[model samples]
Target chain A: MSLILKAFPLGFLINHDLSEEENVSRDLRFERENLCLIKIATNLRLEDVNYLMENLGIPYKYKNDNYFLNNGLCVHWESYQGHYSVFISANEKTLFEKTKRYVDLIKQGELLFKNFDIMLKRNTRDVNSKEIFYYCYKTNFRTRLDVLEALKKHQMENILSNTENEIRFKYNNKNYKFKRNNKKEMFYIELEQKISLVNIGSGKKSLIVKNLKTNYTNMDALLKTLTERGAFSVHSDKYNIYCEMSGMQFLFSRNNTRGQYFLSVDRVSDEELCTNILKELDEEYGLNIQDIVYKKIMERIKDKNMRIESEEVQDDNSIVLTIDLG
Target chain B: MGKLKIKLLPDGTIEMETKGIKGKKCLDYAKVLEQLADAKTEKISKTDEYYQNSYLELDESQHLSDN
Candidate 1:
């Protein structure tokens, strides 16, 4: 009986309708004051943010967790995340413009891609047409590696000087010399020739010259017999007779030095295919370039008198850092 | 003293906040941090604190001679 309880505040009870509108306005303002929203480019990691803060000479205290952002601002930083509603004051908008510009500049430097040389370094070979034709002989669509293995398995006994860079052998009373360039995967056969008499019509003999061409035909027939058991297909384009096999084009052209024809296998590079492969790499592991940016940022921050409060890995593999700028 | 809090998600996105700093100085700080982080600022909304003024201090000394 001595204590009186009021169900509502005195002002709210006095001005019910006006107070209702005011209360709504005040609630909205409170929400706006508590939260600031930001969306950053996706793929930025915790360490990256820390590095950036350090470069900016901002210090923070550390706490590691995946807790939701409750104060100041919440960032929609992950690319996979959807959009969020944000409210910004007019004066504070200017501050963001500068930040936006810096973000663009940093992204320009960090998001770099690897070129052909770096992408295909391991698969690259110093290709020479003459060299490839000699050692990497192929029939139909079989691979160069397959043909080479077959030759090795069948002709191991006939090999005269078989080393890392050279494989010289005598087969069918004819010498075959295959040499690989030093520090190169390409192999070349030194020019060798054999001349003989061939029977012509009406009891007569004609003088004929044979070189790599004859051996090429013989080897072609032999490998075809062993593998596909089919005839070799030939293609010609004006000055050269060629055979396309497993990303390689073997061409037989006249060699003026020996007055004979020699085989030359050139690699047919598919630009579109290479481009697709590089694109795939960029899509799969492209974010690695950000590491360079992080490193550069850390470099700028080093010895800058900023203090790191805490650093940790969250359940989602994200990193959190707090720094204090004293 | 000024403070910064940073979060890096596994997907390579960065979340950052500045505390105990206000006004245009915060903007400058944001710009520098974004540049160092190599991230683009897609969206930015200022909190109430961003509209508040920051503090400044000056150090000075006075000397007097006695006869």
Candidate 2:
């Protein structure tokens, strides 16, 4: 009965609304096996099974060590000495009816599909072997043929349409799925590749110095100071600029908040350069504070109509401003 | 006469000392300087002179007593 039932040519089951099939006979089945059959069973991998179970939200029932779909369509796996084969077996009557209707619709111009070159020939050695015409349905997926041609031109391999809005392809040893919404015309690609880690060995602590704050909130002022001190920018990007000072290379990165910049010494282990930069920056900030306070004091004195009796500079570079109250 | 001695340090610290301003008046100037510099005051030490009254205030009190 199984051998006779296997002779029937049935395509893979595609899930769709069966509102037009409300009047079809439900008890119809193959004469010999009394079970609806699917000949082109889809050979699936673990990820494909996951995509069916998780992404498509298809419910399955486990029975007799095999997973059965909504209507007794079994998805079973077989193992032989550590090698595993997984495939879907269709046994539902409704699904077989839909497949038959779909084939008829394609033939009658109500539906559309491209005729594949390879004819599905079941058992050529048997006297009852017949050539069955199988069609690759275009309704399941929609994409411009030019877009597929362009993808092929760019060396994208194994491009397959899995659903209405999804196209899975492989490029640069990475698998990705491109999905598009026909209504909104918006699309995005999801990466379906495994991440591999590269080991970066350590023990070169003095080579890379990171996150050294210059305490200047303004990046322009900081760069100006560095430029004035004979450091020239060698390379620059959006966030970081590499500079060289006195034959040593360093990086200035805007990795901090509020327009602040950080200095990272790259590949140079000279502690003196770091100390010198800190000293110069310190002096610059101190001078800036001194100027601001001096201006503020002078403005206050002018507003109060006070007289400056004496202005002196001490040996330690301290400024003394004597104000006389009138 | 009031003297403001400001030392700009190499470590980005500002040291300010107010002389001849007595009776907490120097604290006002300290606050003003800190605000103008946009810096936080790490330490403040008040000398004995900060507690002393100004010569003008002392003279005014003496003159009021004579009157």
Candidate 3:
């Protein structure tokens, strides 16, 4: 989803209805998806603890996958089919403490994500469970609309929407759903599958597989999916972004900073179809894309007659250039 | 006949493969793509394509001429 967390107000998780024994045996919890984890003890007032533990179960990342890390101390809310639990064994004192350390660091984490787009929420993983204050911040723009506008300005034609309030489209073979939520009074958008054009899956060999698997627009759906599949991530590097002209999908990309655009057709299994599409693109759009990219680059630099210095390299998929300021 | 397949990955990787080309000549095409995409080689598998007959010689400019 385009819902990037920009800021988070620090809050505390408290337990007021604790019996002296319940207080000693129960631990305070943190709430989150990737950041929060809590165990459900049967002695608590939760009625369906047994049922949920049996049916929904904890995330497989905990039970099956080698994904958990002893990063920070944060115990979060665990919900199952409308039932919620936020307590764990006081015996997990070490985990609870470590998770707490992370929770406390979240106060510091606020500074780390202040300028960047991120999604955030407040943890109220306590016994007095009620409506908690959850917040999300968009890091890339003042608001989500700005993202939509920029996308439209660059590539708007490939879309179908019921009113401008909500739009759904496929770009690069991935579905994008963007819409305004009237009830929450927020605009939300999500990529059907996470695609990074920069080919950055985790960036490095880190065990922390980012569990960005939540549907921020629909928390109910998010919870249900989590309960069904558990937390998991599968990395795919082979993907495509395409544009249509004359009933053919041409792989397309627009690099504004580089001032370049690319379109190509390949492996379509039908050579005739490919030839036909190629003819249309050549006749309608022309074959001189280098000129188009050069012009666009000049326009971006605000000097229509700017002299450009460009380099194209072979034996490596790269082009490097420098603008002579002198 | 040889063909070039270019792929743009979700993880921000650009990959190109040469099909039906013989011998070290595929590397010539691959080098051109590598230059275009500007990505460092993370892994390379020398398939049978690298072992087949060197049917053509590459010029200094990489244009292939039949041996």
Which candidate number maximizes TM-score? 2
- What lDDT tens digits, residue by residue, belong to model 3 across residues A1-326? 01122222111111112211222331323223212222321112244333333343333334421222233322233554465543321222345564643333333233222211111121112212223323221121223445455456446346776654566665555555555555344444443432111111111111221111110222222223222322223111123233332122344333332223344542232344346644443332321332333334445533322233433433442323333322
> Which segments of candidate 3 are over 4 A away from where they belong?
A1-46, A49-326, B5-16, B32-38, B47-67
Task: Look at candidate 2 and tell me the lDDT of residue A124.
Answer: 10
**Which scores higher on DockQ, 1 or 3?**
1
Lowest summed lDDT window (length 10), candidate 3 chain A: A196-205
**Chain A only: TM-score per candidate:** 0.19, 0.28, 0.21
- DockQ list for all candidates: 0.27, 0.25, 0.03
CAPRI quality level assigned to candidate 1 from its DockQ score: acceptable
Better of 1 and 2 by DockQ: 1
Weakest 10 consecutive residues of candidate 2 chain A by summed lDDT: A109-118
Clashes of each: 16, 0, 39
- Model 3 interface CAPRI class: incorrect
Return the candidate ranking by DockQ, descending.
Answer: 1, 2, 3
Choose the strongest candidate by DockQ: 1
Q: Is the docking of candidate 2 incorrect, acceptable, medium or high quality?
A: acceptable
lDDT comparison, 1 vs 2, better candidate: 2
lDDT of each residue in B1-67, candidate 1, tens digit only: 8887766654445677888886657666667667666556656667656765522211111222221
Ranking by TM-score: 2, 1, 3
